[model samples]
Target chain A: MNVEQVRSAVLKLSVHNDAVLSEQGPHCPGSETLDIRHFGGEESIVRPAVTDMHFPEVVFPTSRVGRVAGLEKVRELVVEHHRLIWHSPLQPIFGGNEKHFWKAVELTADFHAEVCGGPKLYSERKGHPHLRERHFPFTIREKDRELWLDLYVQALRNVAFPLEVAEEYWRWVESLSIRMINRRTTFAEPVRVPFNHIAERLA
Target chain B: MNVEQVRSAVLKLSVHNDAVLSEQGPHCPGSETLDIRHFGGEESIVRPAVTDMHFPEVVFPTSRVGRVAGLEKVRELVVEHHRLIWHSPLQPIFGGNEKHFWKAVELTADFHAEVCGGPKLYSERKGHPHLRERHFPFTIREKDRELWLDLYVQALRNVAFPLEVAEEYWRWVESLSIRMINRRTTFAEPVRVPFNHIAERLA
Candidate 1:
């Protein structure tokens, strides 16, 4: 589909989202953005990279509601707690070729550990995914990297994990995000601003 | 959103649909003209609805393909069985209360029985939705009714319902769509149509 069509589909999915758009906006630790919108009729533009981001809410389809509500808190918390660290600037970028440098970070095992509610879901599913080591094959463009982050956000955003419970989780995501990137040796853009110390680039 | 925004959203959603604007247009059953801009995004001020329409192969979302494959043979057919019926000419203008009238009919128990595979799902948990009696309290306004229909199309389109195995089931959905309304006595212009005969306008 062209960019506009993609945006239209995303918006349609967003409009009746009683399942995902709980209480108006979504909060995650270290999510990327894929802002979809229409310039005119039917056609859409997708800004697939996320910066200082927040998931504004829309109505979710009904079927998803039960699934979100039904998730075990421990597993939910496990995912949320890592959000902050994942988005942190202190971490190093992934060093080699990769589709999503951040996703390649060796952090999911740790993220699952924080879930405490249901840690076994991850540990038993697979021991651990080595980060930098596993990402040496795919070509990672800036756009592709951003898209990976966007998808990660999507995976986490739809399942409601509450505000207070989710905030701390976000912090962990931010922290882990810094460690996911290995491009510190080459590119010098998309300035990584610190969480609490996010600087205003404009007057 | 304001009326203009709502209208724009409608225009975008309808016009941007890939299935409606393919090289092979309006071949699917139940397809209707909607001033949709065809591929190549050329601006078109007006285009009429076709009586019958089908979705393009790629228009089906990846998520839907997996779901449609799992539905029982009958449930799968509910997507577009009665194009001949819904395609029939109607006194009411297209996009008029006809679609609204559709939402109303589908809210009935009798209409539910006739459709191939739908009778069980609606009442399985919610019980018989005393549609006419319940609708007495609510008169859906012109705009709300239109939006309501739009919402249904968004929710129901393709929806993983299989092809012919689901055809009879779809007839029932089309049938029940008429029962959703309770406007028994009206002096409104544009003669009202029977719920049962809706299949005629849809093909």
Candidate 2:
């Protein structure tokens, strides 16, 4: 077992209290103490039970505000963000085509609506977001993520979101954006654009 | 840019000569020397130039002995291997249903045929076998990989694969099996099986 698998298990446990975490065989015995504890009270207090293992410090938003500016407001910001990306230098990442751009916009809007404590539009319509798998065809980089976040920042200002609300929402968006980065910036060779041959044929 | 990304880029480059491998922005400037070189005398020799970077030693068989055994013999072994897995404890990993089992069998056979230099049936039909993404829904551990490998080992013997050929084939299978493992043996909590809610509803 690697550090990543250990971390994944710990994170999964931190979220789901009732789930039993185990592997099929005897390996990585050091993770025995990596667990979570819940204290009974008016407010259920939950905390990590292990400190020996090197766990990366994660800054979770303490606020349960859910929708910082409510569902409609979040949707509006998301739509604006997608619109900017549709016309921005990052357009090629979304296929540089109108249909693909709009489809991505719709998907993001639905995803944003669902995540911001609104209707479960994305899950109901698209099962699970599987964002990594969805973006696998594209070689996303740090610049692309920054470009994406910049659009959202502009969208937040355009929508007139409160400073605190915008900051909180930005925190989540920033972290999520980092998760969607699928490629490295210093590769020995350039990753081939998903279907260069097909595009060449069309050209 | 990081060690993992650098390693992935080099490995990808080493395998596919025509593959254009480039990372986005400049991050790891040192990787410029970590490259492959082609020497032409009688046969073009290709290998990694840099040794400082952490790269797993991969033994790629240069001999195009496509099918160690004949294609028909390989197919026979692959069929038996899947049949054994279908009835074994590993069945649950493939969905534990007849339809899913058979579909998996067909896909694996196609994949095996292609890898053994038989035909491009798998790629032509299914595109790139995003094997990791395909198995992402399942929590695959080291033990599962061992079980899968065991089935193949037994099947190879059953088909009377030549000892030298079988050993060479086993080397590749063992390495590929390691790549398929996506999880560890112990977690802080159990992984949420894909479609848990739906399964509960059905039960």
Candidate 3:
């Protein structure tokens, strides 16, 4: 086969759901076997994978809010948080016109609300929330993530978010924010502030 | 002044060529004084700077080529290097349709040629090349950068780039590639491959 045809075939097989691609060859060492299944009930096709790099996953805090009032509370908290951050000193990080900024805020609110057990507004409108890809345009450093979290804490306190679910929510945002950091300024890992440390502020 | 007015004023001052802004107040600790000047000959406006973060700069290998056939040789090497990478296993890193890929390649070639002592093609067509911001859409890791350099070395040998100029070119790309890495897979700093180590390969 020509190089183009070979690449096309490999790409087709790699994307197939029932394709079981193994990279345990000379190309990549110590790579895991990927058992990708295609929706089509086609026979499994095995191929030597190119690169097995995986993008970071964003796990939303839906279950935590589901235990409480769920969607309504999530919407309230997310909207208030976005508002607080929009007004905060971190506003420059948005780096776009006012219209773009508000549009981003709306989309973000929809995504957060949907993820945290609200209606499927974000999914229905924007399909999948590729949060990392969406955030790639902005240069988010470790300090920026910290600043974001700080504003979020302030928003939670200002909105009087329920202290019962505050810890889980904080944990979710804290971890997820780390994934948004596209720029590294220091060799040290990002700082982690546990829920107990900010419990009194939320109360 | 209102927040928007203050922001606009700050942005104006920050972008000014002669405005000396200080972030040494309670806001940012140990921040250096920024002597930014405005081209409009307006009086310097000193203000409490917002964030003191600086984007990484891309220093091209213009001087090294000036010592040889200058722009012509740089263009030849850059074009061949790009062609090699486009055909390499790293093709997926471009992540677009064939038309988009070719456009990116052309734009990149223009930018590289302009930066490496060629004509003002990129700047005339596209404004400032915010390299990091432009590359934000791609999930470039340390491994990807290494793979890029590997393909680059092969390109250099294939094109038979001058030995004298090759070292500087390699150094330029090696350091510049690190800045392109937005995703951090390891806390350790990115690997550095000295030119001498790959001297045999280039020969």
DockQ of prediction 3: 0.03
Total backbone clashes of model 1?
92
Using all chains and alpha carbons, the TM-scores for the candidates as numbered come to 0.21, 0.35, 0.43
What digit string (tens of lDDT, one per residue) describes model 3 on residues B79-198?
777787777656666654778777767777776655555567776665544344345445565677888888888877887778887875676677667656766433235678889989
- TM-score of the second chain in each model? 0.29, 0.59, 0.66
Where does candidate 2 chain B have its weakest 10-residue lDDT segment? B36-45
Give a tens-digit lDDT track for model 2, residues B1-203. Answer: 54333533454344223122221222122223312121111221222121111212223221243444666666677789888887776765655368867776777776665666666677667653434334534555555776787677677667776554555455555554554454432221222222222223222
Model 1 residue B130 CA deviation in Å: 75
lDDT of 1 at A41: 14
Q: Which regions of candidate 3 fall more than 4 Å away from where they truly are? A: A1-59, A63-67, B1-203
iRMSD per prediction, in order: 27.6, 27.5, 23.1
TM-score of 1: 0.21
User: Can you give the lDDT of residue B203 in candidate 2?
Assistant: 28
Residues A1-203 of candidate 3 have per-residue lDDT tens digits of 53323433454444222112112112122112322221011222222212112222223354445446465666677777777777765666665367877777777777666555556677676553334434544456667788888888988888777888777567667766765676643323568877888888877
